[model samples]
Target: MIRRIFPYPVLSVGFFATWLLFNQSVTPGQLILATFFGVTSPWLLVRLDAPPFRMRRPLMILRVLWTFAKDIAQSNLRVAKTIIASPHPPPSGFVRIVLEMRSPYGLAALACIVTGAPGTAWISYDPVDNVVVLHILDLMAEDDWAASIKTRYEKPLMEIFE
Candidate 1:
């Protein structure tokens, strides 16, 4: 009985919370509408085929989040300094990293992390080769950047998702 009503309970709760936060009201009508949409959207979305997701180590997720946040802040500072100090702009280049992570979800999360931080953008990823091409604003050491991504972010994500 409960399963039928809440096919995706987590998604339903997220939707309801997001609606309330966006609307910024707790009126009867608002609650009714949020509840209706929250319950319905998940049911509709469940039809789509999604990859199997399982967190092997839940505690590692927090570590990944913290590392990502720190990297973003550091990257912002580095980029800002480069922009302010450099009269002749540093040469920007693309670095192709050979990745060992095979999980689609893990790869997607890595894409977000790499692209979200300043000065770096995800150019393209070759799933067949398991290689990610990244465009960096200030390309100093190609090997160092690749190592940093693998050690700082990719490794943690692998632990959590794979």
Candidate 2:
């Protein structure tokens, strides 16, 4: 019953906070409306049969976020350099990366991290074979790219989600 009332606590809190922020003042009408929407949305979502997520390591999630931020900054600089150096055109292509992390949340995080980076974009994911196709703005060496992704992103994601 309690779970049904608040199926997604984080989402509910976010919706409520957004509502208050948008209104600029938390009047009774706004509060009631936000509460009703937040509570009802979760109940409707629950009917769609979503599995519960278990976050294994909260600290590791923080670490992943920090690492991702650093990578994004570095990639942005690298892409900028490649773009400015017109003599040597960037070798951009798609590469399939075999994934080891099995958790849905981990995969979702990985997708966001890859797509968020300026030089790299996630194209598609194969759930059956656990592989992801990514397009890089500059492709130097496939082996090097795969190794770096595994070491830099996949390793931390494995620790956090798996």
Candidate 3:
């Protein structure tokens, strides 16, 4: 059945195409190896028993991507300035964010987004409390940082994934 053989059709085709591109030739050996990988990856994924994610408001994903890109660019500049100036000691501290998203996939995406930002690093997450701890290189105001994250990242993710 299609469901069992290729639970993730997009992933399978991408892997197969990447393998062919990497090999740079369509030899029998390459074909066999690519087929093996494509088949095995789907099989392994099927065993994981992940729920089918219903992505509501798919355009929100684009919004999230754009926001992340802008934040990364701005954060890179801010971090660079902090490193070069060395005028004052860096204001680094940890802050705990209470997350409303309970889905594992959503939480993982949130963690990636927070950590990908230059000034912040995800420390630990407590599932029971739905809280995430993050260390920020420049902690000017906890409320401002929390509000920015909730508004910029979490709200969009909640729309898309939750």
Candidate 4:
């Protein structure tokens, strides 16, 4: 009974708090609405046909997150330097990278990592060939960019999600 009532207890509490915070009221009506939102939201979520996901190596998350943070900082500095100091416009081009991991969750995470970087963006992904085109602001070498994405993001995402 408890499990059915609260599929995700923490998420329910978060929704409850967020509703109250946004409304800025503890009146009886607001409280009832907030409570309804908190409970029904999870029930609706459960009804969605969302794909199942299981983390294969849950502990690897910390390492991947650290890498993402460090790289974001470094990429921001590199992009800033190019913008502020470079005499000529930095070379920019798109590189196609072949992805091996097929899990939707892993692919989505990879997309986020690539698009989140300051000087790089995810242009398009071809599902037929499992290839993703990434636009890089500082295009030194296509092979280097592809290799970096494979090493820094794709591999870890595959390990965790696939």
The candidate that wins on lDDT is: 1
Better lDDT candidate (1, 2): 1
Clashing pairs in 3: none
In model 1, the worst 10-residue window by lDDT is 44-53
Q: Which ten residues in a row have the lowest lDDT in candidate 3?
A: 38-47
Q: Considering only N, C-alpha and C atoms within 3 Å, which residue pairs clash in candidate 4?
A: none
CA RMSD of each candidate after superposition? 2.2, 2.5, 2.2, 2.6
Q: Each model's TM-score, in the order given?
A: 0.84, 0.82, 0.85, 0.80
Quote model 2's TM-score.
Answer: 0.82
- Residue range 21-99, candidate 1, lDDT tens digits: 9999999999999999899999887787678788898898899899999989999999999999889898899999999
| Model 3 error, position 46 (Å) | 1.5
Positional deviation of residue 76's Cα in model 3 after best superposition, in angstroms: 0.7
Per-candidate clash tally: 0, 0, 0, 0
User: Model 4, 55-108: lDDT tens per residue?
Assistant: 999889888889999999999999999999999999999999999989888998
Query: Which is the better candidate, 2 or 3, if ranked by lDDT?
Result: 3
- Cand. 4 TM to true fold: 0.80
Alpha-carbon runs more than 4 Å astray in model 2: 22-33
Clashes of 2: 0
Q: Rank the candidates by TM-score, best first.
A: 3, 1, 2, 4
lDDT of 3 by residue, 1-162 (tens): 886678788888878878999989899999999888887777777778887787888999899999999999999999999999879868899998887887777778988999999989999999989888999999999888888898998888888888
- TM-score for candidate 1, residues paired by index: 0.84
